[model samples]
Target: MKKKLYLLGVFILCVVTLSGCIPTSEKKSDTLGLESTDRYELLIGLNDVGTGKQIMDTQEAIEIIKMKLLRHVSGVTITVSNGYYYVGAFIVDEATLNCVIYGADDESIAAVVNEINSDMNVSVLVSKTPSKYRLITP
Candidate 1:
């Protein structure tokens, strides 16, 4: 019986694997297209978790900001603050992106932040001490 069950499981696995081989629609440009082209591109806000205010300008704060932005932009695993990173329903601008950062090295974060900030409408807040930021529509 054990042998039979094992064979059944293997058969099921094979079926499942082979099912994925089925051909799918190759043309889905509309679904994968970028949907952003309007005014009020994006808004970035900073929040100081320690002071309970919106402020980002420290070593620790920068780390958190990068972590959050990377997740949203690159679809990587990341932790975000509550009520933060809210993407609104508006067409984003594809030029001169507006991003939010927290650190003395603003240029460094700008590179990465801008990557996610492009053609997107939202607000972001980055802070230190349990640092984090909130991205929302403005």
Candidate 2:
């Protein structure tokens, strides 16, 4: 009887531990805000106006661009990376925008690009391609 009770207690402890490891259905559903059907990539390039041109801080610019992009598409994932433009032996800093836009159409993408161009001082280049992978937030 004592051995059976000990085994039962251990079994109950194991079941509770395993249950905690399992994710709730609500959490799984909340993983992504966008629909999985259609997605696109938007790559924006930023450059200075001229040799002596001044621009906003790199991080500030990235955040500003991200906020503007989010306004157009709420579920999009925006990632920013640093890039360099080589002018002869000189290297210049450039801000690169990598956005995974969910459920985006050509018209919506074009509109976002136009908005970015008008709001930012940096020259912008927009590229759109169907996304092959889903954007996951960490």
Candidate 3:
């Protein structure tokens, strides 16, 4: 009886110890050239809609755009300089800059864009790049 009880305790201890080694999430392989689908870069440029110059201040426009973007993406990096905007975000497949900047059917994205457009008369140029392509930041 003593020998059976001792063996049972040892088995339970081993099972508990090994269970901790299991991973909770899928691990990425170290294979070279593995592409990441979740990375993207967004560039936005503000320019005069017509022959006249842009009336809104460049810095203020940048801040307004930044705040709107933050509402959709959590860990986005946004910077603006000389009427140009740069945004870097991960896991941003659904919430795209073009969708947010240009009015889209998506309610969340459209709301932000419409608000900005209504306040400013400047035209916007939006560009999106995949993760493989590197963007030149200012």
Candidate 4:
């Protein structure tokens, strides 16, 4: 009886100790080519309509846009200089009709794009690794 009890305890101990050593499959991230530490870079193109005229170049406009975008971007920060807006060290260039947004994960990126793209003027290509950016207005 004593020997059986001792063996049972040893087996239990071994099982407990080895359970952590066993390998388990890890879940894939929603973002392609994205590690837990990796962040996304979004190249933003702001346009008013199909005419290709870039508007809303003002502090108020920037504030409004930032407010709109803040929900999707985690810990967003904005700055103004050189006729451009900066979002967490990323650039918002209305002059060139292009901009940059940084530090978004895959879900957040989708949300951000969806919020801005109401009239199908925006399309996203997320199937690629490392991501791609193309904003077309028509």
Best prediction by lDDT = 2
101-121 in candidate 4: lDDT tens per residue? 544677876776677666324
Q: Report per-prediction Cα RMSD to one decimal.
A: 16.8, 10.3, 14.5, 13.8
As a TM-score, model 4 comes out at: 0.40
- Give the top-scoring candidate (TM-score): 2
User: Compared to the true structure, candidate 1 yields what TM-score?
Assistant: 0.21
Arrange candidates, best TM-score first: 2, 4, 3, 1
Query: What is the per-residue lDDT of model 2 for residues 1-138, given as tens digits with 9 covering 90 to 100?
Result: 999999999999999999999987764553446444456676666665553243676677778877787777766667878667787898876667777776667777777778876776455655555544455768
lDDT of each: 0.42, 0.69, 0.50, 0.53
Rank order by lDDT, top first? Answer: 2, 4, 3, 1
Off by over 4 Å in 3: 1-35, 38-40, 81-115, 132-138
Q: In model 3, what lDDT does residue 17 have?
A: 91
Q: Please give, for residues 1-138, the per-residue lDDT of candidate 3 as tens digits.
A: 999999999999999999998777877565554443334334444544453445556667667778776675543565554433333652211111232222222454445456555655444444433343223368
Per-residue lDDT, model 1, residue 112, is 50
Worst 10 residues of 4 by lDDT: 119-128
Regions of model 2 farther than 4 Å from truth: 1-38, 50-54, 132-138
Model 3: which residue pairs collide? Answer: none
Estimate, for each residue in 34-107, the C-alpha lDDT of model 1 and write its tens digit: 44311111234344324434444434444654565554443222332334333386432211113332322444
Off by over 4 Å in 4: 1-36, 77-103, 119-138
